[model samples]
Target: MIPKHTVDRLSNRLTHLKPILSFEIVFIAVFVTLVFFTGGAAAQAPVGGGGGNTSGWETILDNLYNVLYITLQYAGLTILVLGFIVWLSARNNSQRSETGMKLTMGGAAMVVAYFGLGALVSLLEFIAG
Candidate 1:
């Protein structure tokens, strides 16, 4: 069991971190939005050279999927690293430790979801076929 003093300290640290965490989340959201918009625009823009026949919608979807996949991969890695640092630094605080573990698991889940997307697409294709 964690001591009261450790819990108090961890609470104080979390209070200080709350604003920073909010800002990080907002920043990530904005970055992702920008990536999506820009990627969408680029995907829609006409190519100068003629390419083999392909559906424009399919091309756009592929680009969007790639961008999202890469973004999530990086975000998950970043979250996992941050969670590890927090976990290591909050050894004495059960609350902080739990929060860190949750973050780590969430990040891992994101990465897994990213990879699983391909399988999901394949499954859909098979079903459609």
Candidate 2:
């Protein structure tokens, strides 16, 4: 049962330290989570012309990239298709049409960029070789 005056005084003292205290708390939490969860038990990266297993950093990164591409492909397609439905249902309204157009264009751009980038990388490799 602390006194109200004492509690008020403590609160006032802590007012100026709130930001730093919050930052330190968040930093510690993230550091602990990353170090314990993801940073531990990680394998070595493939480099320096070493003959080794395929479970190195390159494979890990490629898998991550593939995951990213699949997510983007599905998400973009869903948005674009839903936007078309919404826009078509509200065809008399220009606002809805514009929204649908935006979605379609964005999805098209994502699909194009995905394929374009893959092609560009292959082209560069071919040119280099």
Q: Which candidate comes out best when scored by TM-score?
A: 1
Query: lDDT by residue for model 1 over 1-129, one digit each (tens)?
Result: 999999999998888864546877999999999898777565565577557545776777888888898898899889988888877788689999998888888888888987798789889989999
Which runs of model 1 end up more than 4 angstroms from their true locations?
Answer: 1-54, 125-129
Model 2 RMSD in Å is: 10.4
Error of 2 at 18 (Å): 24
Candidate 1 lDDT: 0.83
Clashes in model 1: which pairs? none
Can you tell me which runs of candidate 2 are displaced by over 4 Å?
A: 1-39, 43-55, 124-129
Residue pair clashes in candidate 2:
none
lDDT of candidate model 2 versus the reference: 0.78
Report the lDDT tens digits of candidate 2 across residue range 1-129: 999999999999898774656877999999999888876456544568667656576677778878877877887788778777877887589888898888888877777877876788689779999
